[model samples]
Target: MIDSQSNNNHFISESGYLSSILRAPVYEVVQITPLQKMEKISLRFNNIILAKREDMQPVHSFKLRGAYSMISQLSIEEKKRGIVTASAGNHGQGVAFSAKKLGIKSLIVMPVVTTKIKIDAVHRMGGETYLFGSNFDESNKKAIEIAKKNNYIFIPPFDHPSIIAGQGTIAMELLQQDAHIDRIFVPVGGGGLVAGIIVFIKQLMPHIQVIGVEAEDSACLKAALLKGKPVSLSCVGLFAEGVAVKKIGLETFRLCKKYLDDIITVNNDSICSAIKDLFEDVRAISEPSGALALAGMKKYICKKKIKGEKLAHIVSGANVNFHSLRYISERCELGEKQEILLAVMIPEKKGSFLDFCKKIGKKIITELSYRYFHKENACILIGISLANRLNEKKKIIDNLIINKYKVIDLSKDEMAKLHIRYMIGGYPSKNILERLFSFEFPESPLALLKFLKNVSTYWNISLFHYRNYGTDYGRVLTAFHTTKNSPKFEECLNNLGYRFHEETNNPAFCFFLKK
Candidate 1:
């Protein structure tokens, strides 16, 4: 058995900050999850790719380690008084599981929009649940209020010493499991997991590179590192809810700035692709935040043209809500570059469609939508599957353009992917006065009706698109018939107080929605 205290003394410096998190007392509740070699991925990348299976932990996440470590070390009096915490999902389960194991009362405050699977998991583990607010920041405040009111010890999700130490234990296991590790990729939220891993790796192996990964829409750590302090994001994307923290923890930022070799951000598509990759490799599905490290590693290796090096990515968690899979599965193909989006214009004549098909010779057509309005010309939105390199897409596009087909690449266009693709139909109508706007509102029943009630009833609703990703906010792509283009429209929108973007002249909107 490894002596936790001796390990602390052996590796820690005189600094209290580093010494306090040398080892977490999490062995009783946390397991040393397997460090599995990703054979197919290694072959493809021409590198030794390994995955630390933290998703296999009792709570199916690394969070339990930290939660247990923090709670287990509390004094008897503190334990009797109980504990309180707030989490988007995984951390609450961790705390609930830890509290149950330790015979301590626990209450978890979660955002109202948290997925049912996670909330149910916490309740099943014996934690009292409080659904409050719209996001983590709001829920965290409520948790603090309750803690103060009840005089319970408040355990922060990722900011405390013992919590960080517990997560760092994974690094100890990684070193013992594989000494040949050349680089380690870890996902970052408030930065607890990455900070913990870094404290150990930098002190012990110093030569190994530690890379932190974050969602492009929720990159608090990267933002903090660049700005030299934690700054709140104006808005955060909820696709990767687990790591949707708008700000980094104070202590976590300090450690990450000092030790992390590099920090990279990945888009939602890349995250979805990484989730698919993990599923392919181990038949294990990872949540968006969980697959973040793999996505970053892929981008890093490709950009640097690095090969044949041994790399490891932390599979942070696997507590994905099942319903979210529909969105992920739909997007993963595009993420992997297997699906390509193209806008093609053809002659609006008999057999012109056949000519277009001939030009796209032998390619698998995933989607093809064409509507002829003008007597002389027609436009079609097409999705094709590419069996060859992504460069092959460029060649295909060039070939179509050479044949007098106007081609626009919609593969990288966010608007096209999220809204336009599904709503591809109907040619431009004359004097209809189409105006496009994107609106954000709380995800709740009658939110759409409430929005419509606020807008002027004089305008006819022309185009509308809405999708719920099981998040706190709902986004809607809406078009209305209105000729009022002066300050009146702006004044009306300002009065409504809804966060909206005018897409009236947006390129994608013009291409697909407008005449």
Candidate 2:
């Protein structure tokens, strides 16, 4: 059987794989996406930066190229027998669309957690969708089982030659678009896109650097390259869900090991910044996985101080759901180092709050939160905006410390930003009797405030913490001083009538918050 392993020493141009890719019949369904220059991004990096807009395709992704190419080359008997596959989102849509056009019936198995928008897109394209398990591997296993039982052809997302060749078509277009590109940054998921690009580039324009970018949370390619074989990841980051594969494909891994020049990983914040950069440069919003390549390119350029060279990045897809934009927008500034999170301590007295604000000066405050509890001291969470200079943050921190404002810089703390910032009460030192209550209350204006106000009237609220998780109901982890519970305490609970559970003996609360 032919595989990437057999093409070991032969350049891609001489390999039979290239001939197949060149003859791929994907043009019927796939568009030749534009390779456009990003002027704003180019200026920022002092280089000619370009983005290959794969998101511009009919499915708003590059997967259609591979999916259609693979299906079109199948034997007539294989088409009659139908096909089965698994995907996170893009590839499912690709297969569905291709199957519809080819008059072929296809069954797609997707993770139960796959985004609703993506599932709907696949359904619209005429693929039968089955939700199973919680990740790509789980769904893929189910797809294979169904394929085996029904005598159906199994279309592996990234492991087959036809898929790789179809994806390689993008590199073919890229070289024709800009023959002088210094490097190409491609995001690595199961590795189809990068492997395909490398196969095409290494054969012809071998001088151009082919770098692979991965989300630090799910760097399967980087892991495989290091270990010289594929390994299953215990857990993968879900922020960039499109690229969150537990294991790399065997064929894709082999091609990547032989062809890729380097691999780099970037944090979720860097990706958020890249999304913002794409919006600014091209007036286009890219999904987290799509912006990944640009993020890695920026990191490489900044670290190496590379200048005046042409760079290209594959903007892989634009299938981001509308709701996720809020989270991405909030983190982009922090990723760009234009925002800093801090915990500040000030006297819980009149005029102290104003004095703290005065120390911060005219710098804009991105976020601020404080609730008085009749204590000698109060800690508040604040986000400060900066002017994009590296020293601006340090200078502001220096000023705060000089004025004796107790401050903890949480700019570099991941947990602090993700979970701790919203839980700002910290460990309480009060001797008051506290009862922890976890509540599921309606997410509405004044719902939380009203609950707190009612409880505070009867018993001093020792601890209060809340962060919305984008659901109809908001979750609150709070503690009330029930030392001197009166008739009003029970009255408050009945008045709110929200679902809640007391955690007086919960080990987590006892260990972390109990005084």
Candidate 3:
């Protein structure tokens, strides 16, 4: 037997086994994918920018490199019985796709609430899925049970030597492409990717720096490093769902602690802004987690005033849902964050709602959504577009505070968005309603079915109430975005026997087409 550990090529190292982790007892091996030099990013400070496009993998993610590498090195018997894993989506898809490619059965356990697109992608990749648990922690527990009960190999998404070594290949390739690289930015989740890269790079050249980037809401590595121990978070925010891990893996933490130079945490707005940059500048679609590294790199280099550096950003994957793009689009400018909430109050009569909009909307109107039911009071929910300047945004809210609109800032709060917002109506209205679900139209018609929480969708309704009450009839109001592209909706309304108000013209119609 040969010593297959990294960094000791000294005496009697198994030249072959040590070289290819695949042959090593508990490690996986991945061949380095070529790196593409992006000259545009390089033009700054004589620094060269190279992007490792891991998104092109067979599973459309770097997870493939780890999954395939790890599975191939497993015991032959383990291979025969196949493998199983738990994932929010990406890792499961990678393992399942790898298993299928290698002619083995595979199982993927995922949270029940995972989006349909991700679920479909896993199925399309030939993974048998077990939708279990409300979240990743529970799904992971279920995977362990299934693995033990069925005597199958448990292929973790991360946190194992084989997986980490496989991920290390990215570092190998990066060095090969730019050996003199000064720094590499990696997105952190369970920390496997960053840990592997740091390990491999450190073993070769201890001088180069490796930075781990994470969503601020889920900076497990940062917290662990700062505390000098791995501590699970009580709660996690999920804007960057890809890297929204509350806990770091044992092996991953150890390796990262040994080799990683620094870890950076970025806000959801910054990550979303980075996503938009990738989309607009590079014609690439990156999930919030994937873009974290790039965003961090951009921020890190600037903050440190370090120029003339060679930087590598791992462009991890692009399995984002199409409907998610709406939010990405809506918030790319807003940095994908808003103080969203619902409000209700007794109508005092005459222009009260407009007063609220005028008070709030005069400065910002990112997205306004509301519906009214007839009664003494009205309820409305909206996502406020906060100003980039905190003080100015606070001013708008301060005004609301003085006016007493019963404003609630849900951007910093998720519990409100999930539970309280829907409760805006009276107990009678809220309890009496069978359901209240809100989702947006996709870029196309199929989008409704694709992204809508339920098949049944109310028409695009934007109903609000004013203080003024008409004696004969209530002024039924609605809003629609019309332009060269609104004819489709207009034709549908025409076929449905609804016409716009003649006075308003141009497809501006209220209930029953203003009849």
Candidate 4:
């Protein structure tokens, strides 16, 4: 066992975390998860890629380590009072499982939009459940209030000393599992997991690089690093609900800033791709937030052009909602850059489609959408598969342009991917002055009703598109028919409390939907 008193390091001495982590009773409830080698990803990246299987824990997440550690250390009086916590999913399950093991009661407060799978898991683990708020932050406030009212001890998901030490136990097992690791990639939510890992790794194995990964839309850690403080984000993406934290915890930010080697942020597409990668390589279905570290590690290796180095990332959890797989399957190819979407202008005549196909050669067509829209010309949206993404895509586009066909790349267009492709048909018959906008709001029946009530009362809706991906947020593409060029419509949207982006001038909308 590592002794804190024998260590001369100032950080270890001041924090006393090395001893606390070593003495933590997390192993009683949590197992030493395996460090598995990712054979397929390793071969592709030309690096030794390993994954820490935190998803194998009883709660299907690393959260149990911290939850059990903190709860086990509670005084006798505190234990009798019970414990309360707000979680998106995994942490609540951990607390519930731990409390059951200790013969104590636990109350788990979750967001209204949380997946039924997680809520059910908590209940199965013996936790009394209360659904409240729309996201973690709001739920956390309610949990605190409930704890105060009921005289229960509040258990925070992150941001406490005992919790940090419990999570640090992973780093202890990691070094023991592999001695030649060049870098360790950890996912960041409120920064607890990454902070704990960094504190332990930097204090002991100072040479091994410790990197933090975060979802691009929920990158509170990166935002904090820039501003030199734990500033709150206005909104965070809910696709990766586990790590969709609006602000980094105060204690976590301090450790991350002081010892972390670097921070990397990944988009939702990359996260989807990473989930596919893990499933293909390890037969593990990881949640979006769970695969965040692998996505960041892949981006880092590609950016640095590093080869033959040993890299490892945490597979944090596997409690994904079953309905989310459809969205992930649709986006994984795009994230890998192995697929591209294009809008091509073809003459409105027979043999034009065949000629276009021949011009692009024998490449695989993943999707094609066409309709007779005009007498002179027609627009067709196409999806093509590419082995060499960058070069092949360029060649296909250049060949079409050389053949006198107007080609617009819709591969990177958000509107095209999320709405336009599915709703492709024809534009309005009359030349209507329409304003197109994309909006996102919390996913709930009440929230949707509230959104419609507010927007429909103010403007005449011309086009609307929405699909539920079993995520916490609802995405909608809508058009309002209006002759006024005033700021009143935008002002109304702002007051509606939904995130909106103007897509009226977007190329996809202009080519396919505008009259």
Candidate 5:
């Protein structure tokens, strides 16, 4: 436990962050969001689960608190000069709304892939918006340039002291709402929110744990902690666009590294599952980043086998892109382990389908994709709904194996989930050296056209499939007719700049698409 008096004195003397947070005038435009009990989640996990509803704020996010706190403290000259900032989405909306409230001009530079919903929100709040770059880091560089050129004050999204202090106000409200809380799970992006909460909570309630959750693909805070410094990631996942920062801020990382208890990273699937949980229990449609803390909390509880503890998580925002719901719904069942996908090779004969169904018994078949290949055997992609995932999946695979049918568990295959399931079709008529690849490119109006032009110009594209799941990046599965020693092809792909993986030998590809 910390010495409350000494710790408080040390923080106040060193930085006065505690005092700044206490005196923050965020309440002028920010809401004192509710601490809501998640009844269904509580019962399911055998714990008292509470969610701080920051999604209820004016911008539908807690970001406005920090944005307002920093902007409201600016000098008359600074305010007159206006402000410029970079954001993925939510923070831009927060800054736009706050600047409008104070009758100051604001410029928000966001990544080109930012959802239209957020872009429109910024415009509605009277902020001039500029779409730039592919992600936050790139847009951040642009914002700094804009600020300097215009002689406007650059308001950082999470790095500044005022921003951290403003975010720390959430911690003050949390303690007042539930003094008996055992743990607080905060979502980490640039580390502002988690750093703010950790500093305040560790000093005031040292016994209570503060854990930071991050999306695995964009885990800047976790990466920074491991490296002992704030490091920029080569690439970040865009699924949770709000928290897709490539690097943790300097000051925020220092505080988080010192006071944060642990870091948990969850995948997009688990985040989707958490979103579904929030919607079911609270009737709130949370953005992927908003449900991130709950996803990590669920993971932590399962890993520790802890029960009956009072756990709280921040529902940080609800600025969800409507089109993204389709992706979330598709992944949520898999995330919760309520469904399993399999590639089963069965005899291509009459009654084979009936026998397979009989073997599956009462389990619901959610999806079935099959195409005629040869007469001897056929590969089929199947999705089965289940109650107990591990045991049921094992039993199903075992039964299929006992029947002398080859089965491949594709439940965790990214290519299978994203492309193979939909592209089950006959192979080429003539045998050719086909190499398969999966590519991810930034989503935009002309991204597909550019990708097609770049890829098809050099190589003969034997197979191609592209789909938009309302994410910042588009997933494309394409195949090229090339020999194994095509060094030139590899060199060209290197120059292409998009992130890609070779899936030539993938089992799903072999079963479903290979000649």
Candidate 6:
């Protein structure tokens, strides 16, 4: 079995960082499985596409390989104390799995925002858990403090040497499995996986290109390169929460500077689109972070005209929440196709709708949200989808011109949507007033206060809309009286309060299904 001895004596000056990673238990090279059709369409580089299936590793992701190796390096004394970590997602599960096998006490601290699915997964693997913090950063901070106070061994997600060593073993597996590799695209978060893989490959193969794939919303590498130092991002997009890191780890970043070829950032829409493609082609439910490599590669191929190149994207994980499928479906179209948002003013007459439909024709309608303002003026917001690599959206715009139709494509103009869409809906009047609530809103009633804060200054509400299910929208519905003098809905409810009525035979409330 490989250990610290091989690492110590192998390469002190030139390869010490890489040597620590080479001795991981996952020594076998991940098989370089060639996808037949994909390789034939060669890019700017050489062909013979190789998919190094690190996803096939224990725990179903490459995390185990690193976590196991990192934990293994602990001294006998340290091992006796066991380990603690903070990960509501993959890292928590990985550490737990590793600790369980090693017969160590594993404690995982997760953020309260963590999904039930992940929490249950950690528990199933025999890891004790503590839920704390509102976000990952908060949870991580608490975990660090706990480790220091309790004297529990702190197993970091990607910053530790043992972890990096275990992760690097994937590179060993890749080289040993197939020596002929052109490029490897790995999903990146804190740079652990990419750093480990790159260090090993460059030390051994030196010729292979190791690219890092990161979410466009939180591109630590791109920001770091631009700034000439690591900087924390103000905010990051949440769709690919797994890899949405504000900053890269110190140790991983140091190695990445030397080994990684370059880092590519892809947006949530693109990552979601890649997830759909992977699901359809491989029947694999890849998480957003996991599918990032494929999305980046596709974007790169289109932009750089990169052909004749052997490409492999990491299908990193499958621990996807079932509820997120709707999000995946929504963004998939936007990712694959350049979106065109238009507000068309058509006559409210009978044949006007049909006339506009005729102008739209074959282009797919990705989104359709409508508003009826006046009897003569009804507006329909349309999101038209166009292929990024192939279709020209201007053709559709040109058709609208020839047919004497008004058009405003907001796809390329985000500022237009941010500042204009709300104003575009209707003239600010009593008719436009809405009592909006959403389940996604934080539990604090600040939005309600904001609404009340603005009241009596402008116009009074004539109609208020509220439903119990408005939790999805977050604007709770109180009883709204349409007549003037503006009755206070809340006061009446407070006075009379709630009424309890039971009707076993009530048709609306019946649970029985009719045949």
lDDT of 1 at 339: 87
Off by over 4 Å in 4: 1-15, 485-487
Global lDDT of each candidate: 0.84, 0.83, 0.64, 0.90, 0.88, 0.64
TM-scores of all predicted structures: 0.93, 0.83, 0.65, 0.96, 0.96, 0.77
lDDT of 2 at 316: 97
Clashing pairs in model 2? none
lDDT of 5: 0.88
- What is the Å distance of residue 394 in model 5 from its true position? 1.7
Candidate 2 vs candidate 4: the TM-score winner is 4
Encode model 2's per-residue lDDT on 311-393: one tens digit a residue: 99999999887777877898899998899988777888889999999988999999987766447877788999999657999
Pairs in steric clash, model 3? 28-162, 331-336, 349-467, 350-467, 350-468
What would the per-residue lDDT of candidate 3 be over residues 161-247, giving only the tens digit for each residue?
667766777777777687988889999999878877877777678899999898887888888888888889865655566776889
Q: Mind giving the per-residue lDDT tens digits that candidate 5 earns over 423-513?
A: 8985998999999899997877787778777768878999989988987788988999987787688888877778899999999999888
**Tens digits of lDDT, candidate 4, 1-515:** 22211112224442588888889999998999999999999999999999999999999999999899888988778889999999999999999999999989999999988877888899999999999987899999999899889988888898876788899999999999997899999999998899889889988888999999999899999999999999999998889988999999887888889999998999988999999999999999999999999999999999889799999999999999889999999999999999999999999988988888888778899999998889999999999999996599899899899899999999888889999999887688799999999988677778778877877886889998998887777789989998777568777888887788999999999999998
User: Residue 40 CA error for candidate 6 (Å)?
Assistant: 11
Spell out the clash pairs found in candidate 1: none
In model 4, the worst 10-residue window by lDDT is 1-10
Q: List the residue pairs that clash in candidate 5.
A: none
**lDDT by residue for model 1 (425-498), tens:** 65456757778988777766666677787675756778889976555567789888887564466677767656
